[model samples]
Target: MKRLLLSAALFVSITAFAQTYPKYTNEAGTPKSTSKPPAARLKSDGTEMRSETVMPSRITGDFQEIMERAVIQNKEHNYAAAISLYTQALNVANEEQAWRALVSRATTYQTMDKPNLDKAIRDLTTIIDAQNAPQKQLAYIYTCRGRILQEMGDIAGGCADALKAKELGLPVALMAGLEGCK
Candidate 1:
């Protein structure tokens, strides 16, 4: 009698657990629902509820076009136009595009009549601090920041960045002319 009751209890518990967590889809593997909820639907904490479905923004095409235009503007020596387009690209950019846009904007600033070294430094520092950037790209960013710092008369800071770039495997030729890196 005890064995029978224990077996029944175990079976009941397994059935209850299985019923509580149903499969998200049928055997065909298609999603159970295709409809998405309205974006304005939110919980008390200003977060999306478990039942709410959010769609990802599709803007990579627009981002690429804006970045291309920015590059063209930069090549034409239209620093203001290039900077504006780069900013727009940044708005819709993913991780890779954001880094590229920031670097391009920093380079554009360097060519301006009155270079905004501070802004360039901020942008570069953002990338560095994110820590998810590729090593080669980080090396280039550090080198660029180092050059800007040198231009701004921050010799020690420039040297530090230069050394960092070198440590990250920047070509020896590129570091050859950077003072204090040797």
Candidate 2:
């Protein structure tokens, strides 16, 4: 009876050990794609295969493309290319799009090795003078123009703009730097 019990115990242990761990395989099996299927699929025999329908973009305009390319050129330090693209974008852009292009171009001008303060001021002023412009954008424009004014030795103008920006709820910590304001 003891030998019989031992044999049964050994059989149970072997069975448990065999089924304890899972089998791992290196095969990738069939590919599962989450993206919309290709518009056209070709089989090995060069025959077209049916695929899931894919939708094309509805946004058709050169303005967005020009703006995107201009931003890329600006980041790469190719100011001339960026400026040209921005100009093209402005020509094809609507009023709101034109505003964005102007602001971007003005910022790029300010960032150049030789800052174009005149053009920057003009761009900011245009935005400020636009009909129904947002107050927050106006505040930013005022602060930007004020900095340019101060740099160009117009202390009074700079101070006045700084005061305006402060009144518009923008933080103007640099007001102390405008010596002529007091």
Q: Work out candidate 2's RMSD over C-alphas.
A: 29.7
Summing lDDT over every window of 10 consecutive residues in candidate 1, give the lowest-scoring window.
Answer: 22-31
Query: Candidate 1, residues 1-182: lDDT per residue as tens digits?
Result: 53344234323432433354322212322322222223454789999654111335433336667877988998888889998887766656654446666766776776677777776777777678765456876876787677667667787888898889889987755543345655
TM-score, candidate number 2: 0.59
Q: Each prediction's TM-score against the native?
A: 0.64, 0.59
Q: Where in model 1 is the C-alpha error above 4 Å? A: 1-61
How many residue pairs clash (N, CA or C atoms closer than 3 angstroms) in each of the candidate models, in the order given? 0, 0
Instruction: Report model 1's TM-score to 2 decimal places.
Output: 0.64
Instruction: Give one digit per residue, the lDDT tens place, for model 2 in 107-127.
Output: 677666777777777766766
